[model samples]
Target: MTAVRPWDAFTSAEAEVRAMVADPRWQGLSLHDRAHVLAVRILVTPDGDRWLFGAHARWHLHDPADGRWHPAPPPRGTRARQGRHPSAELPLDVIPDGPDFLAEPGSTQAFIGPDVSERLTEQLRVLLRAAGRKSELEYPLTAFGEIFASDVPSTVAAVWGAIMWCAYAPAFDGNERLITVFGEYLRRPLPGDEWVRWLPTPPLVDLVTLVTERARAGRSRAALRLAAVMADTAQILLSDTRFRPRALALLTMVEPVLREPTLDAGLDDDEAVRRAWLERCPARLCRALMGETDREAHFSHAVYDLVEALQFARDPRQAAATFLADLSDSRGALPARLDHRLRLAYEELDRAGLTGTSAGESTEPDGFPVPGRVLTMPAPVTEVAPPDRASAAAVLGAAYATGLAWGGLTGAKVPERGLAGQAALVRRLIHERDDDHF
Candidate 1:
């Protein structure tokens, strides 16, 4: 057994943890127990600044010299107060009476505050001293690094929001107001610094998880609001290359809830409702994935996944089918996918003889052929041969003339060339038509 000294004990708790793990006494302890002990030691430190418990509380420290545990006095400048309210204190609550910390409001403070940082360096040292401790040691150290590197104010608010919604009930009577404030903060542009860079990932994941759990448990409004906040934050963070992929993954996970069929009953129309819900999904996904050097290859992966799922839907496929169909109809092509389904749809149309061109021929360049008798805005003056560009232009011009004449654009006495002249004629006609019988 290695000898443990006061310097070694105070320098790295993680090192001490590793030494303990290697010790015969700790060999039988489960990983959870190990984590619990590490967490308790972490909480006992003076980090996590939320509630101030005066420094200098006596605690056990393992002595390396004799390979045995010893009573260590608290570090210098530390003095315990007699009447401090333990509940209101900060770091102390982090090491609660139980093994696992509850998702209580005050608990996060211990994990995120300054006191933890001081002890983490020491903790890591201790954990590194033992076998099979490297992996576990790194986890809390990384967390400590993230906490220390985070924007304290924003992180605190986000953590507080998570606690409010998840751990505490009656989450503030003015929860809506609080949400609005946080939403505004989310909308604000953050700087492209290390602190802001780490800001979104942890908080966003926490919010999404909390909202999903609540929504699953039947809190619809809270879930919706949480999702909205998530979407908004995602929009802001999409600019950051490092965080986009994970953000997109979380957004995709919650998309089904937003698109739930039952959620559509309150909308103005089914199509409008569905489009509004889906539009944001792609916009946010695209915005986040586009131009990302690491993630560019998977930029359209989400859209393709949704398309494939829609094509194979076994039940209530109508909703997904209708969404893709409307997108194709209005947008000319599926925004992300490679257009396999589009080709199939066109082939089906051609097979039905709706399109004059055979499937075997190159009837149209890329999209569906324009209808022949739709009173094309500019009618052709003569029969156009195949691929006759000039002739096609003339035909279109004639169609435009015919449309104009049918609408009285040329027949009116007003000037006839420019848009201004056409507008004057249309205005006179509108007054005359309304004044007249028909």
Candidate 2:
């Protein structure tokens, strides 16, 4: 397959030296007088092609059939005269920093070392570029229950396996989405009783053993995937008192990986949030069902963009919308609907409370922090009306920022808002159309 240079992966050695040196990937490296030698780790996708990632600026594709590497813009090194048959076989071709600007792949200095941070960062960037049209950031922060819905169980299992295997870096909160997704990778659905009939009673033990062995053998990626799977497994076992022994055993097995710094891992994380939400969800639901008053269900599901939550709640109004909502409309809500729910919940979370956590504490039981009212007052209704300053300000805080930023952005670019005098034409048309319709 053709390997394209990822737009984000193109910075010169001099320009990115500081950032690279600080990276865990470049640990214990001395470049002194020599040029940069990128330890390219090729990620072989399902399409029988590979993407070589790690070089500072350049990219490569290796054809497995004959075992050859190909770089874009034919290399012009000492090996250039040798004919580019096998990239690995090619001689170290150091060209000056001119038109054929980038370094050659077969430079004697080039070697293969699997990088953790830089490699994962590039992988995530590539996924964003390929899978999404926009969003340097992506998805619901942590939905431990969702990966079971994926159709590709084996693939999911394998990917999670790799992540759990390789995820040993200290608490890295740089990419919330990536870390969250890594945890989600473990959300692989557990096989039913029938699927597990052949195994020991508590299958998690054998699974943990296998994962531990793999991790010891330097299979970090697979280890990561298993870590995710075990996380969900532990979540399911949260209510099983009898299974405590097995559950504790499972936790012990995966504790090493969990110790690695990850926002989605550790005691206060998505699982905590999930468990807390689950514990209170039923009570919140009952409250919503009981509401016969003019008041909305303060603790309902409307606040969370349940669908977006399934994906990282990236919609901005995430401030106001993510907290308390109509538990009844738990799936999702529009900005307006979410706003309404927040107002409703705000009134009831405490007769005198702000955003209702049963005890009026900031974080709920499961480690999910309930957001206080970002908008102290309700947003004014706008129906061809003047913009409400409080409503707009609330938007910056609790509501969507882009929803309002668009006015200036669009105006500077194409000025879609028409002339003020056009109102006369609009009024005339309304009058004319009213008579025509009647």
lDDT by residue (tens digit), candidate 1, 342-413: 334433443443322211111112342333311111111211121222222222222222222212211222
Return the lDDT, model 1, position 429.
21
TM per candidate comes to 0.18, 0.18
Q: What lDDT score is found at residue 13 in candidate 1?
A: 45
Error of 2 at 153 (Å): 5.2
In model 1, which range of ten residues has the least summed lDDT? 104-113
lDDT of 2 by residue, 198-258 (tens): 0001112224343443444455554465555555444333332222323333444455455
Could you give me the TM-score of model 1 versus the true structure? 0.18
Consecutive 10-residue window with the lowest summed lDDT within model 2: 106-115
